[model samples]
Target: MSTKYKFHEPTAIYFISFAVVGWIDVFTRTVYRDLLLESLSYCRKEKGLNLHAWIIMSNHVHLIISSKEGYLLPNIMRDLKKYSSYRILKEIRENTMESRKEWMLYLFSKAGQQNSNNKNFQFWRQDNHPIELDPHLNMFEERIDYLHNNPVEAGLVANAADYLYSSAIDYEGGKGLIDIDVLI
Candidate 1:
């Protein structure tokens, strides 16, 4: 991971993007997607991760996140990604319903082999591409809108609020998979 994508201002909200290696669509499975949701929820409640906005796509996740309990933003994001990677790999390995298990594992294993930082498998990529959000400049709203409309732009849904894995519903005043503080 390069220092350019790191979290520098601890209290500043940042829009970050993290994706699976090779841009694999590993999150097509509900199990893998739900694992990320669960981890995010846990981080919000227990780890003081303040999630302003979030969206989980097929293989990537976007977030408007910040520290609430004085935890460093980078550390919190690192923990979330680390825990989710472990659990998701475990789920993939153990899931009998997974048709692409062997291939996916092979790819992940190969990726891990290419990086000494990983012992066996690697899921999420190292770079977060954190961009500090400036609310005054309308950057914050711009990001939130882009995140909500991602699924729509991808043809996954006709409307942003209809995407089950996104915070668009929360922004629409409807309950979503996880609780969020709407920023847009």
Candidate 2:
């Protein structure tokens, strides 16, 4: 069985990125993205996880977050990845519009079985290198900006606010799709 590494700190600020196995565009539809938002919402309300910022791309997700209750960050990530993997795979199976269902499912299934905790397949890569946020304000701002501008840099949208799946709108004084907690 393969071993998974845990994030370094429990109450630390974390910059996490998880890619779809094979970097497949598993999140091409809004259903999977909505699943992610729902999962984050649940984590916030139930698990004391605080989401400072987040961006959901076609095949990956990036976030700056911290846990309020001192729960291990990696454990939260493991649950999030596991739940999203199951929900997204279910959606793909039932989705009529998704053309790459078979291939994507196969890839996820293969990856999951390689790991001891996974039964069928895995959707996300296991490593989530959490960077500790310095007390300096400028560094925090820089990281937040980078997260928001990622979609724009990838040419997915003209403006950061234009991306509905990111927290940029919230920080930029516009209503974003997901609710972001206070960063400080």
Candidate 3:
């Protein structure tokens, strides 16, 4: 409801970050992460999502993105989160090998019940802090540094480019998991 964090300029590239409810480490498994990757791929191909940079951590995701022609960033993000949540929840529900299945589901269900907007489960938290970047300010390099260095800062990888779930590889002149309109 706050305009402060809302996506205002549809054509402006924005830095957005969203977290899993309760900061749950849902992306620890390959399946859950892959589900999100697939959704991002679909958004890029069909929803006109022009991804500049992105990184998916254990509990949250950060993206620098804009939209092509008629698409809106907020709408694309909404669809991405909604579809990915459904896919992730289904996989969690059906995965007999998931050790944290019951606990994760309980948390998601509780979060859903607490929020009036959700009917069943709330995998992703509602607010996506979107900051429209000002090109004149030259913020892309700083933001991209922060985004790419996340895995290294978290001690997940020795080098930022070593992290497979990020666009840092692309910035380092290598192909990443998904296509991106590299800014650097």
Considering every candidate listed, which one attains the maximal lDDT? 3
Q: Arrange candidates by TM-score, descending.
A: 3, 1, 2
lDDT of 1 by residue, 74-102 (tens): 78888999999999999999999899999
Judged by lDDT relative to the true structure, which candidate is superior, 2 or 3?
3
Cα lDDT for residue 126, candidate 2: 74
Positional deviation of 118 in candidate 3, in angstroms? Answer: 0.8
Q: Rate the local accuracy (lDDT) of all candidates.
A: 0.91, 0.81, 0.95
What's each prediction's TM-score?
A: 0.97, 0.90, 0.98
Steric clash pairs (candidate 3): none
Ranking 1 against 3 by TM-score, winner? 3
Tens digits of per-residue lDDT for model 2, 49-150: 789999999888888888877576766777887787778788888988888888888887888888897777788887775677775656678888888899
lDDT of 2 at 46: 74
TM-score computed on alpha carbons, candidate 1: 0.97
